[model samples]
Target chain A: DVKVTQSSRYLVKRTGEKVFLECVQDMDHENMFWYRQDPGLGLRLIYFSYDVKMKEKGDIPEGYSVSREKKERFSLILESASTNQTSMYLCASSLTGEGHNEQFFGPGTRLTVL
Target chain B: LAKTTQPISMDSYEGQEVNITCSHNNIATNDYITWYQQFPSQGPRFIIQGYKTKVTNEVASLFIPADRKSSTLSLPRVSLSDTAVYYCLVGAWEDTPLVFGKGTRLSVIA
Candidate 1:
């Protein structure tokens, strides 16, 4: 079984503070993704990394960035946390190639920016 | 990426089969249909995926017709634990950054 783990399950931060959400996968997948889930809006992609040091912006990438220094770890960084950034953050990893896009997700971290 | 439409919510009882259907009218040729289940406060879990016809797994089964415009997820003898939100997504094999819409919420009662 693929195991995806997150550094925190819940977090609270004040406005304009810097926040980091870490994700690690044991399957050594080549693709890692960060998403935020909000009520009524569903899940929106924030950022994704295809390989080490390679990152791409998704639909909702404002105020957020990502780091993939190693194959097993991916981190999401908020430059300046705001109240609007409060959401349930999710991390997923998947193998690259055909018929291999099935992403394994970690338990999300619910971040509250006050 | 193809847009998917599913029921907002459903109700079922234990020991009964639950079939949730999703519609993707604009599904492309290379696109595949995948289903996910998400419990409260947890990330979504992959359930099944299929291009056409029937594909069965240990947890659920996916049935897609020839037109590929829609798919049905069949959960046999559902239990209370099966209660969760089911999301249906359609995308190409190499499409990065998946898009998930508001999923169907299934509430199973005892």
Candidate 2:
């Protein structure tokens, strides 16, 4: 079994405020990802890292950035949060050894920016 | 990642079998179809994955045809807990990242 934990469950922030959402995975998975979930937009990728100190922009990575300092931890940073940036942030980790099918996800942090 | 298309929502009763089909027009030979179930306020969980023919696990079964243009996920004896959004993903080997579709929202009524 894999356990993915997020730092926050609910967050509220005013406009132009900076926010940070953290995620940790107990399983030693090489691939980590960040995604934002909206009502009608579904889940859009923010960023992903295959290895430490490396990052790749996903479909929606304009307002968000990611940091992967260690193997088990992945963090999402919202620089100057806006109302539009308010959404459910999800972090996922996958075992890259040999071949893997699924990416385990965290509980998700719902961030609201007013 | 191959683009996938499934129904927006579905309605089913308890103890009934629900089959959600996904269409992938451009599925490659090496691509595999995977399914994920997601409840409200939670992330998606892996359900099943298959490349060709039938693949069954303890929770669900994945059926794929020979042409590979489409795939079906079968859930038998559904309960109220089965109500969730099910996503269909077709991942290509050469594709770096996996793409998840909008998914089909399943409603299990009593």
Candidate 3:
């Protein structure tokens, strides 16, 4: 079984504080993604990395950044947390392939910016 | 990447087959249809994926038509524990990111 673990399940942060959400995958997949789920808006991609030390912006990349210094770990950072930034964050990993590959996701982190 | 559209919500009783359809009018030839099930407070898990025709796994079955414009996910004899939000996604397995729209929220009753 593929296991993806997050650093925190619930986090509360004050406004303008820096927040870091960490994710680690044991499957050794090459693709890692960060997404935020909001009501009615569904899941919006925040950032994704295909390989170590490489990152790409997704649909809603503003107010967020990602770090993939190692192959097994990916971290999402909020330089300055705000009230509107509170949402459920998800991390996923998949293999690098051209066929229909499935992504395994971690238990999400619910961040609340107060 | 192809955008998918599905119903907002659905209700079914235990032991009933639940079939959810997703429409992707502009789906590309290289794109494949995929379904995911997500429970509350948990991340989505992969259910099934298909290119065309039918594909069945232990959990669910995926049916795709010749045109590949639409696909259906069939859940056999669903139970209350199968109740969750189902997302339909279309993308190439390599470079495209799995984009999720507002998924179909399925409520299973006893």
Candidate 4:
């Protein structure tokens, strides 16, 4: 079985603070992603990494950045957290090949920006 | 990536079979239909995937017709634990970022 774990389950931060959310996968998958889930809006992609040091922006990546220094770890960084960034953060990883795009997701971290 | 449309919500009782249909009229030749289930505070979990015809697994079954324009997910003898949000996604596997819309909320009552 594949396991994806996040660094935190709940977090609270003040406005303009720098926040870091970490994700790790044991499957050594080549693809990892970050997404935010909000009520009514659904899940929106923030960023994704295909390989080490390789990153791509998703639909909503304006205030967020990602790091993939190693294959098992992917980190999401908020340059300066704002109240609007408060939401449930999810991380997923998948293998890169045909018919292998089934993503395994972590439990998710609910961040509250006050 | 092709667009998908499904119901907003559904209701079912325990021991009943539930089927949720999703429409993807613009699905491409290479696109595959996949479904995911998400709880209230957890990330979405992969349920099942299929191209055409019928595919069955331990948890659910996927039914797709010849046109491949739509798919249906069937859950047999559903229990209260089956209550969750079901998302139907259509896209090629190589597509970098998967898109998730407002999924159908299935409430299985006892």
Q: Give TM-scores for every candidate, taking all chains together and pairing residue i with residue i.
A: 0.96, 0.96, 0.97, 0.98
lDDT of 1 by residue, A47-114 (tens): 99999999999988999988999999999999999999999999999999998999899999999999
lDDT of 1 by residue, B1-110 (tens): 88899999999999999999999999999999999999999999989999999999999999999999999999999999999999999998898756888899999999
Q: Once model 4 is optimally superposed onto the true structure by TM-score, how far is the C-alpha of residue B89 displaced, in angstroms? A: 0.8
What is each candidate's fraction of native interface contacts (fnat)? 0.81, 0.48, 0.88, 0.83
lDDT-wise, the better of 3 and 4 is 4
Off by over 4 Å in 4: none
Tens-digit per-residue lDDT, B1-110, candidate 3: 78799999999999999999999999987888899999989999998888899999999999999999999999999999999999999988774577888899999999
Which stretches in model 3 have alpha-carbon errors above 4 Å? Answer: none
* Per-residue lDDT of B60 in model 4: 99
Q: What is the TM-score of chain B alone in each candidate?
A: 0.98, 0.95, 0.97, 0.98
For each candidate, the alpha-carbon lDDT, in order, equals 0.94, 0.89, 0.93, 0.95
Q: After superposition, how far is residue B13 of candidate 1 from its true place, in Å?
A: 1.6
Q: Indicate the worst ten consecutive residues by lDDT in candidate 1 chain B.
A: B92-101
DockQ by candidate, in order? 0.83, 0.59, 0.77, 0.85
For lDDT, the strongest prediction is: 4
Better of 3 and 4 by TM-score: 4
Segments of candidate 1 deviating more than 4 angstroms: none
Per-candidate iRMS values, in order, are 0.9, 2.2, 1.6, 0.9
Model 4: how many Å of interface RMSD? 0.9
Q: What is the lDDT of residue B68 in candidate 4?
A: 97
Model 2 ranges with Cα > 4 A deviation: none
